[model samples]
Every structure is written in C-alpha cells, then in structure tokens.
Target: MAQDNSKSELKLTKYNNILHTKIYRIEINDYQIVELIALKNGEYDGYLINCIWKINKNQNRTKSITQKIKIQNLTVKKLMAELENGKFETIPDCQDLKGCIEGLDGTTISFYVYKENISRNYSYWEPESDYYYKDKIIPEILQIREILKSINHEFDLRTSFAEFRDNLPKGKYTYGMVIIEKK
Candidate 1:
C-alpha cells in the first residue's frame, strides 16, 4: 500500500551524546540521504526543527546534516552568510539578537520560517490595493512585504510575501514574525 511504502522509506536514529546529534533517513522519489543536526533551547533535547537538511552532498548519498537554528550565537556578517547558505532565518532586530549574531567570529547564522498561502484571491486585498481588508492590515502587510523583499533580494534569501502573510496571525500583530534584512 502507499502508506506502507511511505513508512518503509523513513528511518531515524537518536544519539543522546553530549554533543546532541540525531540522524534521519530521508527518501524522496528514488533518492535518499542520511542527515543530522544540533538542538537548542528547551526544544526536543537535541532536535532543532521539524525538518532536517542536507548540509553537504557526498557521492549523492551521504551529507553533513543540519537543521534550522535561532540566530542566538552568531554575528551579523556571519548571519548573512548563513542566510546565503540557507541555515537560518529571520534574524531578530534587537539588542540580544544583535549580540547573538555578533558573538560568532563576526559571522552569525539565523533561520527563517515560511508557509503557503490559501486565501481565495487574497492578492487582491494586498496593501497596495484598495480592496478594503482593513486599515490596520496595511501596516502588517507592508511589514511582511518588506521582510519578504529583504530575504528574497540578496544573500540567496528564500521565501515570498504571500507565504509570509498567510502565516501571520489572523487578526493581530504577533511579535513572532520579523523581517531579517542583511545590514
């Protein structure tokens, strides 16, 4: 069955060492790769994100694995490099975050989050338009748009305004979303 086929293709290994590593087997189509990453915060002991990434590709099979990490212990220039490298996203614009990025050899990495949009013809209601969503939504929309542009314009930034907006809080300005433009 399709479900069993999917299940058989997935494998995960847990390493509870002091270094905090977990390995995963990922299969898509006929390709498969094994990967791992470090966990931080109070999150999952050692797993950083819900998804694992291939850090390096070796012989089309093995790769150094990685996961999204907060821009906690890196630097601004470093963070930009990581963004270019697709390691982290949305570097916060605050003193702590600035310090976090600045702490790592002047090179900090950050992680970004994105979601797909599903609203019907929501583009028509975009801030630039007068479609009448609300006066307040415009600020949020502009904020999100600026973030999207910063991420997409340089440093190999990946993600879009539509994807960002769809993930915003339905009716309020949640501090959770931020635009991390490389300075």
Candidate 2:
C-alpha cells in the first residue's frame, strides 16, 4: 500500500480555526467615531446621521440614529471564504506591519480577529502605498471590498475631507473588517 502524503502537503493556518470576526469603520473629523460594526455571525449594526432640523438657510442640525441589519448566512460564508482565500492568517503581526503612508485619509478600516485569549487588531488608512500595502494589505482589502459589494454593504468611498470638515457634527464615515472566535 502506498503511504498517503497529501495531508502533509497541505499547509493549514490559524484562520482555519477562526470562529468569529468583526469589522469596524472608524472615522475622525474632530473626534473618533465608530460608524459601523459587522460580525461574522451575521449581526451588522451601525449608526446613520440624518438632518433633523435646519438651524438656518445655510445650516442644519443632524441626529445620529442606530441601525441594525443581518447578513444572510450564505453571504457570511462567502465573506469568510474570501478572507481565508486572501491568506488573512498569514498576514504579519500588527507590530511587524510597515507603517502607513501619511496624507492618506478617508475612512479608517479596522479588522479585529479573535480566537480564545488571542485577539489582534489590524487598522489601515485607505489608499496606502507602502511596500506591505501593495504586497499584502491591498489583496486582503480588495477581497473584503468585493465581498461587501456582493452583499450590498459597500463602504462609503465617496466622502471627501471637505465634506467631513463641513459636517463635523454629522461625523465621519469609514468601513473595514473583523474576525472573532465563535462562542
């Protein structure tokens, strides 16, 4: 009988053991704002700001309201698969990642990965041009963006700094990914 080597030839990573994940969108105008949170368990929650009243012809008041939605199991599974295929487990430790480029601003994307006692947070600015950004980060980000698009949960990439500055009280916008160990 021939000895089987197929199992040994395959390389498995920690992502295989992932039970849950969460993605957060952090935006900063004058302060920090967590605009959205998406979990691997299909729970998606966030806050949306809407104009509540007009203070003047050129001014308006806005209110932040909480919103909750769920991703279909199939879409969640697809997202997980995309992450796995993106080699998320192979990503270097946060400390080892090359610092992001300056002047790259928009929404701050953050990924929180959790397994048991081990939790890691990977945050990045949009349109990073660093070496690691081109080689590793971009691929993962692209995967995430594709998944989000497929699920109709696309990130707000149209917001500009001027808009953020003009509507400081309305809060900034951002989006990203997270993974956590399932209970």
lDDT winner: 2
Among all windows of 10 consecutive residues in model 2, the one with the lowest summed lDDT is: 1-10
Tell me how far the alpha carbon of residue 10 in candidate 1 is from the true structure, in angstroms, after superposition. 12
lDDT of each: 0.27, 0.36
Best by TM-score: 2
Those runs of model 1 whose alpha carbons end farther than 4 Å from true positions after fitting are 1-137, 155-183
Return the number of clashes found in candidate 2.
9
lDDT of 2 by residue, 1-183 (tens): 001231122211223224334433222221223333344565544432211121332333222222223334454455545555655434443335455333334444444454455556554445333443665554545544553343334333234322433453433332222111211
TM-score of each: 0.19, 0.40
Put down candidate 1 lDDT per residue, 1-183, tens digits, no spaces.
013332233433333444332222112112221122333332221111222212222312222122322323233233234333532233333233211111212111222232122111111112223333343343434443453344335322223223433443323221112222211
Residue 5 CA displacement from its true place in model 2, Å: 52
